[model samples]
Target chain A: MKAVLGNMRAELVGAGGVVERNAYLTKRYIWWDVAWFVWTVANTLTIVFIAKGIEATGGSLDVNETMTTLLIGAVVWAYLGILFEFLMETVAWERWEGTIEYTFMAPLSRAMHLAGQGVFAIAYGLVRAIFLFCVCAFVFFSLSIPDAKYFPAFVVLVVASISFIGIGMMMSVLPLISPEKGTQLGFVAQGTLLVVSGVYYPVSVLPEWMQWIAKVSPATYALDGIRKAILEGQGLSALWSDLWPLLLIGFVSIPLGLWVFQRGEQYAKRHGKLKRSG
Target chain B: MTNIQQAAIEALPRRTAPAVDVRDLSKEFRRRDRKLGRFAHRKRVALDGVSFTMQRGETVAILGQNGSGKSTLVRLLSTLLLPDGGSAEIFGHDVVRDARAVRRLVNRVSVEASFFKKMSSSENLGYASRYYGMTSRQTRDLIPQILGRVGFPPDRRDEPMESLSRGMQQKVALARALLTSPVVLLLDEPTTGLDPRSKLEVQEFIREIRSSHDSTILLCTHDLAEAETLAERVGILDRGQLLAVEPADALRRRFGATTLEEAFFAATGRAFEADDEEDDEDREVFA
Candidate 1:
């Protein structure tokens, strides 16, 4: 038991090291992130204005309600976008810089290095998402506060985020194995998810088949849980359905994602890919 | 016994248990591609029936061109990749059976060292120190000293890695490897692209680490002078075969050549410059 704890402590220290390293990388890329945020925010405003205009023209849209929902949804979507952008850039950038091979030679497990990339994404996502959300809400809804249900919603959100990022980690490993195909597929998948995950509107309105697809999407649970909590005053028990699917997704995806990453690493090593980044 | 058997028995290097032990180690990679209307792929033998062993604390420099299986051998011994047709052990621990133990003992320094580009060299080193189980205080004290020894200027320590030169970054990379003082140090082309001065600085640092620490070094390089200077025994790896492993003088004597380059040409039956052209082709895919 003591040994296990000691190992855990060592791992934590490694994690801390990665965090420190990534913070610097994040700082270096701050300007690019700011530019991306500007573009994404502009697109969000255009979306909100269109939604409001449609409601005014006998669209049965509650102006305030629709604005609130769209505002939060857009903010949440920003997180997804940031996550995808950073995830793709992580492997591709490392490979291009010829640093990925150096990373492979480190005494630490490859997964741990990968975990640092994921951590950077999560931290970047939180900052961008919160900033975008505040800007949208202030401009559109006069800073109308979310209700008390945010507590349980936050828990469900955390679970859903893990599963989503787990899937992203799997995608991230592609560039390491086959840079050409990996990058091509990474963009396609992220684009498809953005369109189908109901980032812009409710998943319920989609056709039955589409709804099934949405249910399987990690974003569905996250959005649904958040909407129920903050918008409808739902309690923690009300989030059981959302929570369970995410738990199941996380349970299955984390191990599978990690295994795929390890396999990619091994493939790189056996095929002499380890030298390319060096 | 005849002269051949007697010579083989007499010439075998003395080793209680080899620091690196391998037998019939072969690694085959399956290459997948899409045809006009079908998928076609084939297995390529990267390392075929390779066998060799090194004694404890020996510094072995492997000289091979691109696709000569030098990096593959390093990766296998480091337990990063599995062997398809043979077995390997590091200090008697099976690379496959005791991978965790191997990982703890081994440290690798490659020419293209990875760092958080935005972070300062100090920050990167601090992180590495923590990962290797060093306390923060130890990191604070040792990093600057190590970096200075490797020729990384103190003024540049706080700047982001992206701001540093390639040679400076390589210095920091070498410093990180020494920070742990690992028992097995695998260096894959530790000074490939550096200026001559930086190259010498790195070679000196490697020498310092070997003498100060009880680390067995496996240095893979294309530089012949580097091989002669940094390693006690130089191994010639050609087309996935270890053709010879001997001291520079012994290798030259065996091949009846004046220079290490001439020795390499005589052993591999191809000109050294020809391999440079071949490397140009190998480099195209990555670029």
Candidate 2:
């Protein structure tokens, strides 16, 4: 038992090293981080403004409710976007820095390396998402959710991140095996999730086929649960329908992501693609 | 041999095992044949049935022109690329079956020594130390010590790696490799692009490392002088095959030539300076 615990502690420290390296890179490239933050804020506000535009154009819908819905969608989408980008960029960043060979050659397990990346992405994405939400709320002073159940929504978002990370892990391999189009393909996967997960609209309003895609998407439950808790003041028990599906997907995706990534890594090594630069 | 004697030999300490043992190792790359106009594939042999061994604390240099399979041989031993056939063992650990153990024993320094360009040399070294499972207390002092030994300028250690010259960067690469004191060091043209002064400094460091550390060194280089000066036994690799591995004087005497260059020409029937054009057609696919 002691040996097992010691092994776990060692692995955690190894993973922590990966996170530390990323933090150093982030600090060195502060401009890129700032630029990404600014872009995210602009994207959120643009989506929120569409609701205001509808009201200004004399649409029949309740403008306040529509704005609240739009705000939730925008904020949630930003969180997911950050999560996906960080996770997918895990491999791409290593390739760009030309450290992929050194990093892979290290005497650390792949699981710990990826776990470190996942932990950092989740933490960084959460902080950025919260900041973006605050900025959007302050800019649109009229926006309010009087009965917003913040705790349940936060919990749901955290749970949803697990599945998103798993998906991101799977997407990261695209760049590992194929540097040329892998990163762009990761974005395409994220975009597909965006369209199906009903980021700006209700899933019911989607075409029948896409709605089926939404059914399998962990993001769908995340959005649905967050919207319910904030807009309808739903409790944990009431949001169990969304929570369980998220957990199931989380359980399945994490292992599947790791497996696929391992396979991709093996392929990359076999084909001498680990260090290729275009 | 008697059964008792065989058992006794098997019971001997593994520390006596050769630091490196390669047997019939081979690697082939697939490339598009432009002569066949695009879709036609060709198998280009990188390393062909090459076999060699190095004792502990010995340095062996493999000399070859560009694309002569020196890099491929180093890559195979380091577990960076899978062999198309045969096996390589580091301290009796198989490169393929026991890769994790081999990784713990081997450290590679290549011509293209990659670093996080945005991070400082100190940070990069610190990160590597941690990955190698060194405690923070050990790294705090050890990183600076290693950098100083490699002759990296102390004042510029904290500057971003991108701001440093290529020679300075190469020094950091050497420092990173030595931090863990790996049992096997595979250097693939480590001083390829350095200035003459820097190259001499690096070569001097390589010599110092072999004396100071109980490690085996496999250095692959195209510089005949570097090969002759640093390694005990110099190997000539041509067209993916090792023609001869012997001391510089021995090789010259065997070919009845006064210089190592003439000896190489006599062995391979090609000038040592001639480029292998087949390398241009070699293509790699990531997928």
Which candidate wins on lDDT? 2
The per-candidate count of clashes, in order, stands at 1, 0
Instruction: Give the CAPRI class of candidate 1.
Output: acceptable
Give the TM-scores of the predictions, in the order they appear: 0.86, 0.93
Over B162-256, each residue of candidate 2 has an lDDT whose tens digit, in order, gives: 99999999999998888877778999899999999999999999999878776689999989899999999999998788988898899999999
Off by over 4 Å in 2: A1-7, B1-13, B33-38, B276-287
Report the number of the highest-DockQ candidate. Answer: 2
Chain B TM-score of candidate 1 stands at 0.87
After TM-score superposition, the amount by which residue A183's alpha carbon in candidate 1 deviates from its true location, in angstroms, is 3.8
Residue B261 of model 2 has an lDDT of 90
Give the poorly placed runs of model 1, Cα more than 4 Å off. A56-58, A88-90, A109-120, A140-149, A190-197, A274-278, B1-17, B28-45, B276-287
What are the per-residue Cα lDDT tens digits for candidate 2 across A169-226? 8999998777888988877888788789888899999999999999989989999999
